[model samples]
Target: MQEKRDPLLNITTASSIEWGPCDPSVITNPALSCSFFEIPLDYHDPSIGYGRLALAKLNATQDRLGTVFLNPGGPGGSGLDTLNMLADILSSLSGGFYDIFSWDPRGVGSLTTPGEIFCFDSPDEYNVFWNGTVELTGIEMTGNFSDPNDVHALLAQAPIMQAKYDELARRCLRHSSGKFLRYVGTAATARDIVALADALDGPGSLVNYVGTSYGSLLGMWLINMFPERVGRVIIDGIVDPTLLATQETATAFHELADADKTYEGFLTGCALAGPQGCPIASAEGQTAADIDATIQALLKQAHDAARRNTSAPVTSEIIRDELLSVIESLGQAALFANTTWPMLVAGVQAEAGPESLTARRSTRSARRRTRRSSVSQQNQTRSYSNEAILCGDSIDLRRTRMSEVFGTVIAASRNTSEMFSVVWPAEFYACPFWPVRAVERYQGPFNKTLANKVMVVSNTFDPVTPLPEAEAVAALLGDNARLVRQDAFGHTSVSEPSQCLNAVMFAYFVNGTLPEDNSTVCEVDTDFEIFPGVNTEAILAAMVPRKIK
Candidate 1:
């Protein structure tokens, strides 16, 4: 029986696609023994094809089946890169029986076409557009964005960029080798993934996958479309499709609040750690440290510099510093598996002292002055990724009545969080003007109730996806998902190299044993520690092989 065609399918040029082995070096390190495959740029549509897919084959024994295909959460992040970063973890869990593999998605990583979409040719361009402007109360606080007229002019440029993107999309289809481009959507990608069991492994072989953040959405789509192919799939920091169409603003605001909570956790932990080199302080319970005060001072210095048109100001240095601090602080708990709290405590204390704050303020002032002069003469187009991914996946920002209802919240956040929140006002206007409406909307009754051996993990404090977001995911996944709460602060719960957390994840994936319902907590240090300690090897031993020795 002929199946009904997907209404969203783009039927462009119907041509044959060519597939061949890729340059293994492109994906695998020269030191590793691995091979790769290159699928034509246009996987489904032959006529609209240069885009190539680079697939990496891991070290597995003969008679092996590929169970795992890892995709990092970004709608734009490279799957191949994610596998490489987590190669050690993958090897430890899947063992010799499962072939672990990854591929560069279309328009990402090695398969990226000759276009300016993903790769910014210049670091300066990225820094300027993404990090250049300082906004407050929906006003550009510094540089060329200071005027309301300037804001309108910049917003007007999105259409021009959209036109350019349209041309690029058309060109990509016109020039490709096969009908592949038509099938690159998440649903199609899932189908292609299922075909791998046949292309690379024996009959009836399935896929065991690990997808995080945005990748979780893809995982869900795959599971819904091909439930039979799923084997020990782990969807970490899950995203509910139900929330994508209706509650984008609520989601964003919730995440920001979570970020604040994470920051507070870090600060409290830092205070306890005491004053050594860390700026925030290492002492555990103390109100006098006033880290909030320090943040305010830093911001005020920056604002003053901007106003005076001085050569140096606090805003420039502090913005970058704050961004790095939060990212580093979060990474420690999520990625490095270290108790960065103590170190952060020390760092904050050291920096917040009377002498350091003055120096930092002066340095920031200098940076602000320089940035002000440079950005004034520049004319650049903003990249579309920020809007494309968010708006595409979101419900509608307009439904929230953000500005009117959240005015008090925004103002309070600005006062409490210092100037950082003020510097980047929400892009409320872009959602209203998004070029394309979401083809499909996500509704509630998210699949939290699936009766599967599911496990969910999250940091106590996460900046981007945040704890609340994770909590929502847990609630949505319901009985099927077990929540593993790491006693840490960050964006992703398991990004930190926590032996205990890793053990739970590995056990669940390799042995099909989910953590118990309710809270299963793993403690991680707040700072990096290099010493002969903690027998993590035992946990590693338990997880390294899929089959018993």
Candidate 2:
């Protein structure tokens, strides 16, 4: 009998993309198209199975320069969703001369895809996993814990937290098939991009691409893996692959410092805005320093109230979490500042009466619960796949003790702001108990110079990926890459309001022009609204220069 062939292993490439109308609900534009492309789950072992990636494309309005691939970060962010939302603006940014493409990376998108990374048996079960015993039984998973006694109290809960992580790992194994878990690492995903590039632009052609945030990691891996295939690539909001490749507990703390810097930026910005501009600022002609003191006092009061188990409307933990959240939304800080500043003011201004506090707490709790439910529904597999990818990519955390990890992080946080310290390190706690790893992880010689020089963008005050990491990535890529530093505050420079950065990117992607200065520093529009609403026209207009300088 003849040996049977794996049908999915057929690797012939010839423009397999078939574009058609996207769902009107997803994208209102009639100009865009959507399609699904089949790729192997494990590129090295094609016999394992095949997976389909959902992709969205917008044709160039003018003569096509080439295809530009985009990834919006979130080792789990839906590229298709991002492309649908930003297609028009991105097209204009490219000078209307390139077809833009984005997709849902393997292990993400709809569960209908073959070998999707399923962790829970059902959505309801996933919700319980998020909001139940594990969350409620801890010493309130996050807080500044500046007090030594408070730090010790959190430390004491390590055993309980460890048990919860082990249980979660076991549940993931019980609920999800093990075959696909080994195939979702950044390296394996990079292979899928290679295959897609071959299918779309012919085998081994240079790839025209733009990657942001976690997406920048994808770009780095792509160039290192296939240097000759690199085209005019721009990696914005760089994540240091070197740190990611390590197992050090201190690495997490260093990451937290990025957020801490952005938090300080928020306070400074508020002070500069003044009492009339910043809701949190006292109207008594208080300086930024005075306002900072007042906020700290309110936080201390909330912390004391929570320790007493009083019926306060908000707790120190809640305030800490909200502050961290606002920092994360620094891309839209102006709008978030408008909302969160008022809430902080309200919390500080509330009376000490139990009935009054209880009523306000009840209303806030209801709204938060509703918002959490909606977010959980939308992000059904985000947490699962994020853990899966991190665990699958890094040094196994199973060998490390949770107590040691938490202790190191807590100690490190003392040197900086402890506000975001507790929550940031908590993410890696489950890594020690993760169930699987990729079969062929890419341990890199990232220092290799590429066939084509690439462009990198970074913000001086990014809340997530910091400036130093972007510099490190550029250095690692040797002299082949240029780093553009945007003097701004946000996680990613692309989406944030910056005409100079946009002009730089447009010149590179459209005209193949590199900045004259290797390490160029660009300034943001001072008067630009960080929290500009969803008016795409206004955004595009802002990007387009009325007169070329």
Candidate 3:
């Protein structure tokens, strides 16, 4: 018997598209045009409703090869925003020969569009959920015990975390509309991609795409579900679909372990760079090893103080939060470490006296001001949308008990990664009580070969999606995929400035070229150097490719 084809491939109606200049304040590009295209909220049931998915297009300055669809990840990331922000760099990378296009998926971005997912009615409510007076809110749900050896404290706090999650879940369900939540999964978003392809590229045309981080998950779903429509796909920062699809304790442990390894890499890298290369390195005449030992001692001091509820300025919570910030931007660690490491040191030194503590507080406040603005109101909606999609996409959390989840997290903290164990497992905190599930989720035959070879990129020491996960994804996709191993410390390899990596990617996107070998490893360009004390603006400017006028 023949398999049923996706009806979206047969869609004949042309999408009503309008192009207008983007808001200059938001996107300085005068040439960039933004628009909205209507797609069915539930692709399986057109009767449900139609919603507009926001899109932006930057036509190639020179001759265009074709259109390349881009997704920046986040599960809730705004592809439209990505294109707007990186138009010049992206166009340059594509050799000024491909039109770059991206969209904000349903339930993300503006509520003015149909099918916006809302967990909290207002930003104030969302802030309360994440950073309110509640003791068991936000990061508190996963108690900030800095030492991995603090197993007793972690275990004791597990029940409290579980209870808080339960309450949070109940609150989400009470606040959000059930109808909107049901259609926010990655599978549905994949279908939407197909619909957009059908409309823009003509009916039944294969999709040419690039996705990073969580966006890689979406790409995997698209190719597996609609293999015939796959074309020139690159899944960078690959997420392990097998692990993500299930409720496995081992998977959670492995992810945190990966994060811990990445953190270790940062410390090692900083030490090797020494005093001139790394600001966090040991003082004059001291070895890098000495610096590492000092950091460990300071961390211990802060941990003990927090445990004792002392008046010490540096608490476990502050340490954990700072560490997380560093981890998130590990790709730019050579530059980021200059500021973050100093801040960390300041926090540790604060225990010396009231004067030191006051200075540290002032420095922290100034740093906060210099940092990017808090998540905008639209981003709050995006955050909730991310939760809805993740909950809907993964195995039903309701099947597992909250205690089991908490226990697993505690066990991971104790056995695998004391420093980062809470990060991944904590994401599951509110999942057990998620109010809705996707009406039609994709249970994959993920092993199927695609119509075209897919390119998979992984960082050697990615804090989030690690090397093993990318390798697993490549193995799962069989001969239809090739893994590009980037020897760098970062979440996504493509976004990092690497000439060799970019050359490989460019060849594939422009000329359909694959690496000569099944597995290709690329090294960082030695010429690209990041030094301590370089202006942050200069660092960013150096990273971005020069745009062709």
Candidate 4:
């Protein structure tokens, strides 16, 4: 009898990628090269066939040290796209010594397999489903959980959100291929990293890499899965592995603890910059507290309109979501979308009032009248890779009830900020509804004895990935990891355009140096004035505004 091979899978082979000119659609960087790997869908089992990943590399200009892999988070984020935009700058940041490589991780944005993760059939399907949801439309019903009336009003809608999410779970399952979806997660991607390292730098070569936000989680998985393979790894904007692996997506994770503090910093920065930069800033000694109060008043006015089922130019949910976005992008938000802080504020002035928005309210109400079950929906060639990857890694929450979600949301309000909590459902609320789980999810033993000390960089006031999470990871990894906190706001240290941060990173990668343990604090380019003015060099060196969040 002849030995039989698994028909669905490919045998693990020693493979190498051929770098060639990238397609104009995928990546238009003429200087960079593009290629891919035929990686096993299941690393441990060859029965799952092979999946392809799209990769891009920027070769070093000077004497090459080695290749350094980079991931820009999102769990589903496209490193290939990031490389295209920041190729020159990142190459320079690494001192033009190491080849910078990034890729479209499985199921993310690319024509590569497992393909783009989608819960729906098209943008129209999503827009229709989103019609009845609070995420798409700004919440006018209540401002926050301040008054009992508002709290009750918010809680009453919890079941609706839950019901909508439950249906969402069904649609995702109905639309997505469960077999391939299971492999489109971190553990497999981690294996792919090692495999890519093998192909690019010869088998078993130490992996040099940088990851931010969800990418940091992938880095942790990579380091732990192949401890000795870690060469020069930096995980910036760290995620709380504890919350990530075990908890359901929306259960008051530690990541949001500093969100409000980061927001306060934004308000203060606006006041400091004055009216020229921040529209809502007071000219007469306007304190951060005063600006916050003005925002609160605006929300209240929006709430009154919402109470009457009226539509304003901006709703409470929209403003609250924007608040969260601002905190996540405080550095880049200094000049976001060609609109400064003041202009954004002026737009949300509640100038039109409730009655003025009455005409718009009728149209909004008519569109929202379509109930969930009333229309039959179909799937589209779309992707929500973040949801797929994140929910798969997390412990399942199908058994959860509305009360638990309600309590969690309420407690989350206390934990982060009342305004932020209202907009929480947008990201992780549907995770419980995510039916697919990964084939392999790395849960614990994050403190593996690595080949080197993993450098963890973070912003002190990071809204999403907070500094304490970085501290905890550093403490957990013990001698295997070192933590460096840049005294700045936003999601990651690089967003602040700090020379100190960049120099420290370069030194660590090039010279194998970690900053003095607790004493490491890089200042923002704005405060110190020590870096002179924000020049082209500084902007290029710092992270591109599109952040890891």
Candidate 5:
């Protein structure tokens, strides 16, 4: 029997593609196979050359029931890398009934689809122009705005930030690759997913997918854009599609409402772990007060250092932002059994040592503003790719005045948690000055009756993408979407290993089953404990290579 396919006229599609082995240097997975397929550079215009989408797939151990498309959100993150990282777990969870697959989306700089969106002539050029300036600074959680000094210090950088972005817009616009800006929007990528599915599963196969963070946004776009094609979709760490698509609201308006709750949870988790597991925990298993004091002192030291040097690397704000990151990445493979939390504690303790951070003036002087030599290829390209995708997909903010932009920042601080309001607004700091819009933007009536039910997952207390986002999205999706609340800390369900959550997900992927209802709740099997905590002499002795006797 022949399967049907609705090949997109705009994108170059196929019934089947020749698969090739992945480069051993880049990735060494026996189960993985890689391929590149062409899509339109400008779907609206054919004369514009084509861009290729790079895809990787983990073959099913059994006969493939279907293909599950996964995306690691980043507007710039490599989907292939995600497939590599989670292939084993996803393979096991689904019982290997299906092949797990993903691709490097356009503008991520990994694929041959114009490589990546680059505006600067060279890495050095980018560093030189951005040197000493907090241009395109991703929010470092420094400088709590409750204090007038911190608020003023934060607000003062608005001018310099704006000037840098305006210049960046100019430089990016003049660059040859800037022409690709319109081609990289989420809408276009949504189409690319369809094209890929058609090629892999004979054109019209149902699109089953799992997406987290920015990938969640892509999932929303997919279901709404091609509702009939949805087989089973799970979107976690959701972005409120309605809020993000609005021009007046600004990207920051989606808001990180649960950030404060997550912060509280971090302190609480430390308290729970006690003195043996956490550096800041109390000996007698007390409240979060000890943890708070330890952190507050570090912040004070950082703040004092920032006061002396405007360009200090470790500011109160940076510490706060890093803490937010530490919280978000709580249960990552490395953080789970490694030194993530302790290093954070030890790093701060070392920085905030006996002399109150004045001991570190040797490096963060006004003279050493240029971190040119320190810029890695990964950081530079990821930063550049992040801006290109985020800004390109967004409604143009170039027309918004600097004052209006600053107003959003101030409002985010007042309305949301002042502890991390600065962080959310800085997520798309480049958007307002972004010079291009993708060829297509999905301003949606996101609620559509789809071919299958959509599963929306959220951590009860996600640091960045709050539960309200998933709540609103699920509600908007109405009967078509099932909301599963994971009562866990950290950014998403991945922060904790939850047997309940995994079972629900596997059931959905294997058998198009939605949770019993919108109220379905899943509990994680573990909590956020410091990984490999402090090793006692007894524990160390146990680890020693011993004779059988």
Candidate 6:
């Protein structure tokens, strides 16, 4: 017989637990001391109630309730960090009605929960993981593997690493009394939001929730799971979960291509505006091709340099870092587009100092040098995270000859998405070779048949989740769902400019209001108001202005 379910326990919400002195660590560093809070790892476990999650809270004067959880949507990202960055923007936009609070999930950041299989012990180790492993033969680099077997073989002593992770996870789960490792999906996390609310108070407890990217998916899941429980949900950079599962390849490939387009736009925009005129433009025209070639050439140079510098039997692992940086740089549309302005400003500012030009040149030169090795390392780490979450949460792969099956798909699809087909290949090329499949598989309809309050926002030219995948997600939600089309070119529309779409989101979450139609199309940023700002430049200057005469 199954164990009897305990009757729900009634707990009183505490008013202002003194909040302890704001941790200077979070504030001084901006990176560290943000907000601090703790959650019992095993809310139900009585024997070892030791696990606590350190958190940070960011809010404007308009904040009413104690806090609101801010999720930035990285299964691996630090929520605390997300809130720190968005606090000002959110406050100004929302008129400061709620405090934004975020915590490192069970396995991440300062939470210290358990089940930490990540081998991020030292900078060198982290660098290695970030750069990933490659199968480079002779002087020229060749193929790379995302497969678990290949990775395991490469990290021959990885058993020790694996054991460390397994032990931590076991301890955390055991202490937390959480047996739902299989249920740690978005749905479960949504339910946890309810538990958090209950622990705080009912109904009007939290001010509102603001999420971006994966955060939006979590919001959707939460709203679906408990409609009446939600107060205000601001989901930016929205992702369609349903499409994410079923249309992984189709979505990913298209997004990658879209990324190339966005890069082209950035390059074009920079060229037209000129380096000194536009925040992003480099010293000269610094065309897009120049940037791309600069990055790629850096890799070759780094590899050659390393070869010459090291005759003491250098490993592919060492050279892979520069390569990983190159590959990852290709997908940095969001960063590249944003960085130009910042980098240009920084570069100009650096030019004023005696060592300014030298520093700037040195920095770029260093980046160019490491471009090759870094790419390999980044891919390795990313591949690990991808496998951990994707494979761990996905259904069991019963297909025999996984590699051949995926290889066939790649071959057939080469006509369309050639790069992806070549890079990702198929099941044969997958990481997490022996992933622990979810005990309960995700069925065709990614979500439960709840009323279609699901609001999906997809960019027309997203470089990650393609437009088609967004449509597929909306379709999966069926008649009850809605698809908000952001006529922008990027991943996750909410984060991009589109005040009209944002206003729609505010109305829906604030008052349970939905558009009359199931689909709403928003033009690009130039066509709409940028939220949280009537004048972004002035606001930015006021908030973090440069010292001037």
lDDT of each: 0.46, 0.66, 0.64, 0.69, 0.68, 0.43
| Cα lDDT for residue 473, candidate 1 | 67
TM-score preference between candidates 1 and 6, better one? 1
Q: How many backbone clashes does candidate 6 have?
A: 47
- What TM-score does candidate 4 get on C-alpha atoms? 0.85
- For residues 410-475, could you state the per-residue lDDT of candidate 5 as single tens digits? 677677766676653253656777887777888898998999898999987787788888888989
Cα lDDT tens digits, model 2, 332-430, are 556555766556556645635345444444333223222111112344432465556666877754477768767776675576455566553243455
The segments of candidate 4 whose C-alpha lies over 4 angstroms from its true place after superposition are 1-13, 138-144, 176-179, 332-382, 526-549
**Against the true structure, whose lDDT is highest?**
4
Whole-model lDDT, model 5: 0.68
**Candidate 1, residues 1-549: lDDT per residue as tens digits?**
111222233211212223344455444553223333333333344344324345664655435545577777655556655666666667676555566777655434434331113213333543443333332112223232344553454355444433443443343334331123233445434554655443555434566777776667667766655555566677666555555635544443443545555454444433333344233442434432365455444444454454444323234334434443454244342221124233323333343324444454433322322211111112222223333444544554453332433343344345433223333333322344343433333344456334355566666555555555667667766676667777555556554567677788767755678776757878674343211221222222222232210
Candidate 6 at residue 146, lDDT?
36
lDDT for each residue of candidate 6 in 1-549, tens digit (9 for 90 to 100): 111112243112323323444455444434223423334333344233324445665544743544456776655456655555666665545545555567655444433353222323343443343232121121222222333443334345334334433443444245332343433344435544655565444533533566665576666666655555555555555456654454433333443444444434434444443444333444565665664454334334433443443321222322232222322332333244355324433333332323432333223312432221111222232112222334444445444243333433334334433223233212223322333543333333444454335456666555445566556556765655567776554456643566777677656544557666645777654522222121222212223222211
TM-score of each: 0.65, 0.85, 0.83, 0.85, 0.85, 0.60
Runs in model 6 deviating more than 4 A are 1-18, 28-50, 59-68, 115-117, 123-132, 135-187, 203-208, 227-234, 243-257, 270-387, 397-431, 434-454, 478-481, 494-502, 505-514, 523-549
Of 3 and 6, the candidate ranking higher by lDDT: 3
Candidate 2 at residue 482, lDDT? 85
Candidate 3 clashing pairs, residues 3+ apart or interchain: 148-418
Local error of candidate 4 at 454, Å?
1.3
Candidate order by TM-score, decreasing, is: 4, 5, 2, 3, 1, 6
Ranking by lDDT: 4, 5, 2, 3, 1, 6
